[model samples]
Each structure stands twice: as C-alpha cells, then as structure tokens.
Target chain A: MRLLYFAWVREKTGISSEEIDLPAHIETVGDLLRWQKTRGEEFAAAFEKDRVIRAAIDQTHARHDAAIAGAREIAFFPPVTGG
Target chain B: MIRIQEGDFDLSAEIEALKDSRTDIGAIVTFTGTVRDRGSDKVIESMTLEHYPGMTEKELARIEQEAHARWPLQASLIIHRVGKLLPGDNIVLVATASAHRHAAFEAAAFLMDYLKTDAPFWKFEEGPDGAGWVDARETDGAAKARWSAKSSSKEEPAST
Candidate 1:
C-alpha cells in the first residue's frame, strides 16, 4: 500500500509518500492514525491532532472510520484552504 | 475544460474558445481568484499552492460533472494554477455557460463553492511577519454548507 501526506502534513512528516505493507490490524483510517504514532516523532507530530486531518482512500474522500481493506493508496492532509 | 498548470493563462483567449460557435449559450458567468497582497497585519510576500497530481484532476472533473448534472450547462471550464505565485497573480478560474442567466450564474458559484472545500489544493502564505499554512477556514465551510441545505430542501419536496 502507498501512503501520501500533503502540505503541512508532508512538511511535518518530512515525506510526500511511501509504500508499506498493510498492517494486519490496521483496518480503518483511524486505526492507521493510531498506529502511525508508534512509527516516529515526526509521524506522531503529523498525526497529533488526528481529528483535524482529512483523508482519502484511493483518491476518494473518506471518513476516518472508513475501511481500508484492499486499498492501494491512502492520503492524509489538512483541511483544504483553496479558493 | 480542466487545466492544472504552472504557466499563466490568457483569460480573453479562454473566453473566446468557450464561446466559439455555440449558439445554445445565451449566458456566461466567469470568476477568477487572485493572490492578494494583504495578510492579517503584514503585507503578504507570496503564496504557494500545492495539490495532488492525479487526484486534483479527478476532483475538478467530478465537480464539473456535478454542476452539469444539476444545471442546463452548455459548457464549463476550470483552470487552477499551482506552484509559487506573487500578489495579483491569478490563482484559479471558473467559467460556466448555459442557455439562461440563472443556470450560468448558479453553476459558476457552485463550482467555486465546491472547489474551496472539495479540491485538494493547500495555500501557504509568506509575509513579513512569517510564513504559515492558511487555516482551513470555518467561513469557507459555511459557504459550502449552504448548498447542502439547498439540496436537502430540494429533496424534501420529492420525499414528502
């Protein structure tokens, strides 16, 4: 699976994207956020306020509760500020 | 038409293309968002727009499709610039054409409303004070929420 971070999340996390094996227990986006905190300090800081982060599964907007089963791509970013 | 590019665009040329040989279009509405120099208390030096590559195009196309499904649109165009930009530079453009003024105006506004929230672009502002990511404004949410209310009310009449 591939994970993408954008904007402030990218800056905070210090990477734009990465490919990793889907963890067996991480079935939902919320669970992924929780697990991400154990990765490193940057990941913890990037997801510190998990609720404020928006997510998309395979490029479609999704809620944190949304399942990530069989997904190839997941993206996390701050709420958009574009006009 | 949907374009996500780093280069500047010609507005007059764009309008001319949209209006070419389309007699069915009786009205056209267009909007452009520009980078402003004003910050809270300091003058803004520059603004940078960041967006997802494949996802950005998909979302913009989806917004355009939604507008067409709801309105009698002859055509529509969305052009959003990415990368670094200075004050007074065009940030985004939305143009809609329909046989009636009502559809044209409403669709144009609808496009912008959706783009504000739905699009993945993020703005980072640099100024004399400091540089920071622009907040995900609540007012932008309020602006987009109005349409949801309208849609729900529209559905109520049929559900009753």
Candidate 2:
C-alpha cells in the first residue's frame, strides 16, 4: 500500500510519500499508526500526537478505527486550516 | 463548478460566469478569503497553501453537492488557489446564485464553513523570525457545528 504525509506531518517525516507493505497484524488506521512509530526516530516523532493526526483511506476522510484492508492508499496529516 | 488551480481568478468574471445569462436567478452571494499579513504573534511575509490534488477537488464537489441538496440554488462556483502566495493575495472564492436572497446567502455561508474545517488544504506561514504551519482554529469547528442540526442529513461531522 502507499502512504502519504502532508503539512507538518510531511515536514516532520522528511518524506512526502512512501510505499510499504503492511504487516499482517495491522488491520486499521490506528494499528498502522502504532506500527509506524516503531519504524524510526522520524516516524516516532511525526506520529507522537497520533490523536491529532487525521487519516484518510483511499482519499476519503476516515476515523482511526476505519479498516485498511484492500486500501490502495492512505494519508495522514494535521487538521486542515483551509478556507 | 469547482476549480483548484495555482493561478489567480477574477471575481467579476466568476460572478458573470455563474450568472450565465440566467434570467431566473435574482440573487448572488459571494465570499472571498485572502491571505493576511499578520499572524497571531508576528508579521507574516507569505503563505504557502498546500493540498491533496485529487482529494481536494473531490471533497469540494461533495461539499457543493450538499449545499445544492439543502438549498434551491440555480448555480454555484468554488475557486481555490494553491502554491506560494504573498499577503493580500486571494486564497479562495465561493459564489452561489438563487432566485431569492435567503438561499443564496445561506448556501454561500454553509460552503465556507464546511470548507474551512473539512477541506484537505493547509497553510504554512513565513515570517521574518521563521515559518510554521497555521494551527486549526477552534472557532472554525464551532462554526461548522452550528449547521449539523439543521442539515437534511444526520452525518457525523468530519474530524478536523
């Protein structure tokens, strides 16, 4: 699956997007966030405030509990400040 | 209509296009958002608006559809600019046309309130001291919440 980072989340992660294979244990957006924290120091810092980081599954806004199975893309970012 | 581009848009032209020689429309309401020179603590030199391309358009269309579903609007337009922008530059424009003033005015406000909190765009401010991402305002979420009970559909508010 492909993962995208935006705004401050992108800055902290130091990369905009990446392709990664999800571990069998990771089934939800929350699970993916937890596993990402263990990847490296940057990922840990980027996802430290996991609750504030919003997630989108297949370009649709998603809650943390949303399933990620069969999802081609997922994105994480800070709360939008657009108008 | 929904347009997400890096170029600036003309307000008059947009309004004219929305009017589109439609004699039935009697009222048009417009709202434009511009970049501010000052942040809460410092003077901002510029702002960079970033967005998710495909998702931004899709989300705007969805918001527009909701506005149409709730009001008797003849036409509507949304234009948002991205990339680097200096203070005083226009960021977004929304226009709604209807046969009456009430529907046009309300729909324009509704679109803006929803866009502020739900759109997939972020602003990064640059100042003499440094730069940082603008924090999402609590008041924006409050503004969006005001419409929940009145909406025809009972969907949960998007997480900001």
Candidate 3:
C-alpha cells in the first residue's frame, strides 16, 4: 500500500510519501497505524501522538477502524482548516 | 467549466467566453476569493498552495456537475490558482450564467460553498510569527454538508 503524509505530519514523520508492504494482519486502519509504529523512530514519534493525526482512505475521510483491504493509498494529516 | 492554473486570468475574457449572440444569458453571477492579510488575525506575509494534481481536477469537475444538476445553468466556470500567492492575489473564481438571475446567483453561490470545503487544496501561510499550514475549518464542513444533504434528500421522492 502507498502511505502519504502532509503538513506537519510530513515534518514529524520526515517523509512525504512512501510505498510500504503491509502485513497480512494490518486489515484495518487501526492495525495499519500499529504496524507503522513498529517501523522506526520516526514512525513511533509520528504515531505516538495520535490525538492530532487524521487519516483518509482513497481521498474520502475515514475512521480508525475502517477496513484497509485493497487500499491503494492512505493519507495522514493534521486537521485540515483549508478554505 | 473547471480550470486549475498557476497563471492569472482575466475575468472579462472568461465572461466573454460564456456569452454568445443568443440573448438567453440574462444574468452572470461571479464570486472571487482573494487572500486576506490575515488568517485569524495572523499577519500572513505569503502563502503557498499545494494540491494533488489529478485528483484536484477530478474533484472540481464533480462539484461543477453537481451544481448543474441542481440548477438550470447556461454556463459555469471555476478557476483556481495554485502555487505561491501573496495577500490580495486571487485564489479562486466561480462564475455562473443563466437565463434567470435566480439560477445564476444560486449556482454561483453553490459552486463557491462547495469549492471552499470540498476542494483538495492545502495552504501554507508564512507570517511574521511563523509558517503554518491552514487546517480545514468546521464552517467549511458545515457548508459542504448543506449541499450534500440536500442532494441526498432530492434523491428520494417526497412522501405524499
């Protein structure tokens, strides 16, 4: 799956976007976040404070428990206040 | 009917393009959004807008189509400027033409309301204080919800 980060999210994570191999167990968004946390220090720091992070699956707003099967892209960002 | 460009556009040229010899165009409604000096009273020095290339165009087109379905429109245009912009620079333009003033006004307003909320553009403003990325506002979400809910209700026939 492809993972995308924006705004302060990219700053914290230290990457804009990356293609990652998802584990079979990472079937939900929550599972994906948990899996990402184990990747490295940056991932741990980025995901450690989930209060400010928001996720969207395939461009539409998504929740943590949303299914992630066959998702081509998942984007993480801070709460958007763009006009 | 929808354009996302980095170059500035002449409003007259756009309006002329939508006009013809036919006297049907009785009204032309337009909304121009400009960068304010401040976002929440922060003195913004400059701002840079970023967007997903393909997805941005797709989303704008969809919003335009939705407005057309709701109102009887003769012509419609949505223009958005991306990249670095300063205060007073035009950020967006939404114009609607119709035979009646009501349709033109309603469609133009509808376009802007949705564009503000639904468009996938990110703005990073650099101010005297510091640089910060603008977040999505709850008011914008409310604006989008109004149209979406109206669209959904219209989908179902009114119960007699």
lDDT at position A66, candidate 2: 88
Stretches off by above 4 angstroms in model 1 are B149-160
Candidate 1's residue-wise lDDT over B51-139, tens digit each? Answer: 98888898899889888989999999999999999999999999999899999999999899888888899999998888999877676
Task: Write candidate 3's Cα lDDT for B1-160 as tens digits.
Answer: 8788988878888888878555878899988888898888789989888775565676678778988898999889999988999999888889999889999998887887777655667889998899978866667656666666554411111111
DockQ of 2: 0.59
Candidate 3 runs further than 4 Å off: A48-56, A59-64, A79-83, B20-22, B151-160
Instruction: Give Cα distance to truth, residue A44, candidate 1, Å.
Output: 0.8
TM-score of each: 0.94, 0.95, 0.84
User: What does candidate 3's lDDT look like per residue over A1-83, in tens digits?
Assistant: 78998776787799989998887887887788787788799888888866556676777656777898878989876654434
Residues B1-160, model 2: lDDT tens digits: 9999899999999998899888999999999999999988899999999999888998899899999999999999999999999999999999999999999999999999988877899999999999999998878878888887354322224344
Q: Write the per-residue lDDT of candidate 2 for residues A1-83, one digit (tens) a residue.
A: 99999998999899999998888999999999899899899999999988889888888888888899999999999999887
Candidate 2: regions farther than 4 A off: B149-160
- Assess the local accuracy of residue B105 in candidate 1 as a C-alpha lDDT between 0 and 100: 97
- After the best TM-score superposition of candidate 3, give how far the Cα of residue B150 lies from its true spot, in angstroms: 3.6
Ranking by DockQ: 2, 1, 3
Winning model by lDDT? 2
Q: What value does the lDDT take at residue A11 in candidate 1?
A: 98
